[model samples]
Target: MDTLTLKIIFMIGLISSSAIRLPHQQQNKQNTVTDDRKTPLETGLLLLVFFGMLALPLLYVFSPWLNFANYKLPLWANGLGVVSFAIALWLFWRSHQDLGENWSPTLQVRDGHTLITNGIYQSIRHPMYTSIFLWCIAQALLLPNWIAGFAGIIAFSIMYVIRIGNEEQMMMDQFGEEYQTYMQQTKRLIPYIF
Candidate 1:
């Protein structure tokens, strides 16, 4: 297939995978508390990353002027992107399923949140972050434009660096020794090797 066709397919898969989480998110929102630990800076960073990764890519795909469409990689990279996207979507779906109503978009704990340690969470403390990292890698591989391709990674990295410590702290506070044991047993974003 042509590069453009592959790019389109990857974008569709990425968007569809993200879209599927909306209902689950909304369902869990009702249980979220007002005590969000995500600071304004973190929220701003997240919004910036979201805009760069999602909106900018779509804009570049449609207009092609917002981003410099240079640095085309090998066709095999696109194939790798497809596989990465598939894994990302699957992991994302499973993570959400495992979290169930315990999931929240931000740093707020749900009313009846329980520590989930099964499915994708069995080995990774942050499988959703892993899935997002996969998305970033896939985005970088699939899109030819420099800004559109690499923005996801740059943005996600910033968000991860800023939020991960706080997230773990919150989990540790809530789950106490149970979370400590889980942390000792699992990696943050990757399994077994991270």
Candidate 2:
């Protein structure tokens, strides 16, 4: 792989790892506690979303039409998507770094997990998800394949819908008045415009 690719991966790994420093602490209810683990059905839905994202690129490669041979993406679209993806990755890294040990994929809180209101959090309540959502849509736009494009949109939509509910509930419980005030100031997905 190229150096740029390696650097991106390293950045992503470092951020993700740092954000998830204390998974066990997050699950300990004595913290900002909640029992919001997904139901079996929700878990299945989440798995479908995860696998769909993973499979779409592979399917595109082997697709008989070679991702719609006639529907090549414009060079500008490809360039924009690549750049958007890179930006989304950077945003994810920033959000993750800001989150630090407070991050948890599930609806659990860590000890001393103060509400973060600076950096990306100052604008949107969920910058990491925002970036991922943008990246997913950009992938579809850039790929110019009906299957890949729609799959990414649908898959991410499904994941976000489920994720936001659980996340908000937990945050509301943990941060209480503080989170409520933050929510009033910031949009869920978009910044000031939304």
Candidate 3:
């Protein structure tokens, strides 16, 4: 199919991912935070990710400002995007479902936050990041534009790189031996690999 068709599909997937997370985001709002690690860096990185993954892609889809970055992918690449997006949406939903009220957008431990080490978390420490990475990969494949397509990965990689150590430290501080043991038992983003 054409790139516009693929772009529309990508937008639909984006919207669907948002819809799936909306209720969970709202649920987290009511949660009481016992520990908050949110900082200026966190807020800034969030904005960067917002610009990269959401704003830029939407701009590309709805406006002409980004057409200069437009490019083409093979039909097989588009097909692969469909698959990657499917997996991303699934993992995104499942991560939320598994985390439930424990989910927080920023670095904060809820009043009753427990170490999640079952289901998807059983294998990987951050399925949400994995899902986001997959979405970025799919975005690169589906959007057919350099800026919009690859921005998610670039932004998220920065966040992941800067935040992961602190995240593990936070978890280490919170759960101590349990979180440490969990870390030993699982990988960060991938399963049985780096």
Winner by lDDT: 3
lDDT of 1 by residue, 1-194 (tens): 46578668767976787686998877975774745776798789879788867887787677758544667678788889888988998999888889998888788887777899988898999999999899889888887778888888999898889888898999998999999999999999888888
Which candidate comes out best when scored by TM-score?
3
The models' CA-based lDDT, in order, is 0.84, 0.65, 0.93
Off by over 4 Å in 3: none
**Which model, 2 or 3, shows the larger TM-score?**
3
Q: Give the per-residue Cα lDDT of candidate 1 at 83.
A: 89
Expressed as tens digits, the lDDT of each residue in 17-36 for candidate 3 is 98999999889989999999
| Candidate order (TM-score) | 3, 1, 2
RMSD of 1: 1.5
- Candidate 1 deviant stretches above 4 angstroms: none
Clashes of 2: 0
Residue 131, candidate 2: Cα error in Å is 0.6
TM-score of predicted structure 3: 0.98
**Whole-structure CA lDDT of model 1:** 0.84
